[model samples]
Target: MNLSIDVTNNEGVSNVVLTGEVDAFTAPKLKDTLLPLTKEKGQVVEVDFQDVNYMDSTGLGVFISALKSTKEHASTMRLVHMQDRVYRLFKITGLTEIINIESTVQGGM
Candidate 1:
């Protein structure tokens, strides 16, 4: 499976829309697209996961890295509109405590 990323920035807000599977093979691409957006100060990165049905630990690693970058650079990162199964990974790993994740929409890709 492949991951597709679309990004847009407006008034310091970066919106990232993700589609397809986010596994080991596609995590690097997601990292590449999202990391840079979080490297700037005062940037707010909003990642929409509505169409992201599947995600592996590698994808979590990417988000972790991005989250770290956002913190180091004085930025913020958010994950929204996630599917229940995909959101479970973060919850199971206890990332929900440290990361900003919301909108667990019921359904799949």
Candidate 2:
């Protein structure tokens, strides 16, 4: 399926829900949606990957860039509700150590 991104801002946080595959083509769209949010100071960006089926290296790059942008702005970015397959990708890549992942809805990143 093609990638789809849904964004919502509430209580100083930007919640991004991603559906479908994230590859080189779709990563750019994710980046564009996240870049401006990350630039906002004190804004917490939560990426929900519950609906995502697959992601490639370019997708990973988008998250990394968002993380960096958040840090630079004194904001934060988090991954939420990742599927096991996608979670494994980050774990194997050592991104789990650097990025916050919330496995449960109540789990704080």
Clashes of each: 0, 0
lDDT string, candidate 2, 1-109, tens digits: 4898899999999999999999988888889998999998899999999898799988899989988888899999899988777888888999999999965444444
Model 1 TM-score, 2 decimals: 0.94
Which candidate has the highest TM-score of all? 1
Record all residue pairs in model 1 with backbone atoms less than 3 Å apart, i.e. clashing: none
TM-score of each: 0.94, 0.91
What lDDT tens digits, residue by residue, belong to model 1 across residues 17-76? 999999999998999899999999999999999899999999999999998898899999
After superposing candidate 2 on the true structure, give the runs of residues whose Cα lies further than 4 Å from its correct spot.
Answer: 104-109
Worst 10 residues of 2 by lDDT: 100-109
